[model samples]
Target: MNDRSNARKEQRKKRYQRQMARQQKGSKRYQRTRLNVARIQRYRANCIKNMAHQVSHHLVADSTTMVVALEDLSLKNMTASAKGTVDQPGKQVRQKAGLNRSILQSGWGQLRQYLLYKTFQRGKLLVFVPPHNTSQECSRCGTIDKASRRHQSGFACTACGFTDNADRNAARVIARHAAYGLIRNKQPGQELSTVTLRPIPY
Candidate 1:
């Protein structure tokens, strides 16, 4: 849905840019085209917010779900500019910029906010586990090996050869951490170590 919206926005943006280019800088037509571009941006933001609300509502409305776990993400750090100082330019600047844009567009922060309120209203617990090594750790064997994540989508543990989708494996790791903390009656904000997570049957 976001991809389609982005495509449409791009098409309209190009058309508006062309129209603005043909018009005088301070002309009414140029100002109107500029407003159109702003409107497109606003529409995209509204769509993202709506999607976040829908997703958060669905998760909170699940009867079987008692706790909703999410990564304790730091968007400011994750989306920090990768363009280093002129003396020492950053590597993969373009790639990092694109990643930052995608992260912002995905509305992760917005989704988290929506989930926070919805879960509270629904009387469901919302927990955030540590974000470190969740993807590299094996869900079944509890091994943490960078080599286990051979690709973006696949995870194959080197220690026990446990295999699964990378994202799913990370989710299981997060779930285990949350479950372990709750079972031990750990206080909120107490650290949960990925290394201490127990292996369970897949």
Candidate 2:
């Protein structure tokens, strides 16, 4: 799907460039190409927004979990330009630009906003915990060493030899933070409190 989208975008770019070079700015051909590109962009935006709505609604209404916990993320800061001033330019400008584009295209903010409203409307408790070190901390032994998450998809705790998928571990850490209000120095199941909330109809 992404490949097809990229192909269409590239084709539109070439067509638009060609039309701009040959046609006058306000000519029919130029206006047509501009409108075509705008339509494509609007379609993509609607697709992303619809997907975000579906995912968020499903998470709140379809899932059995009453407590929804999400990491408090600053998408704007995450996608901000890494390029500094001309005199003191930043490193990895191209890589950061691509990363920022990818992040924006992922619709993280849209999903979060949908979840916020849906969760509240459904009477489900939604909590946003600090995102700091949720990925680096070991979910098993509570170790905060960065070496535990040496790989993107893999996590192995250096302190206790605990191994798990990186994303799953981070999720567990987030759940633990939500459940116990602490991320470290706690025994398994200690200080953890779970209160079951009756499902409320929307």
Report every candidate's CA lDDT: 0.80, 0.74
Scored against the true structure, residue 200 in model 1 reaches a CA lDDT of 16
> Where is the poorest 10-residue window by lDDT in model 2?
193-202
Count backbone overlaps in model 1: 0
TM-score of each: 0.81, 0.76
Error of 1 at 193 (Å): 21
Candidate 2, residue 105: Cα displacement in angstroms equals 1.0
Q: What is the lDDT of candidate 1?
A: 0.80
lDDT of 2 by residue, 78-182 (tens): 666566569866777777787676656667788888888888888777767788998899988888999888897899999999999887888888777766643
Query: Tens-digit lDDT track for model 1 on 78-187?
Result: 76656666886788788888878777887888988998898799877887888899889998989999999989789999999989888788889988887876768867
How well does candidate 2 match the true structure in TM-score terms?
Answer: 0.76
- Best candidate, lDDT: 1
Model 2 regions more than 4 Å off: 1-23, 182-202
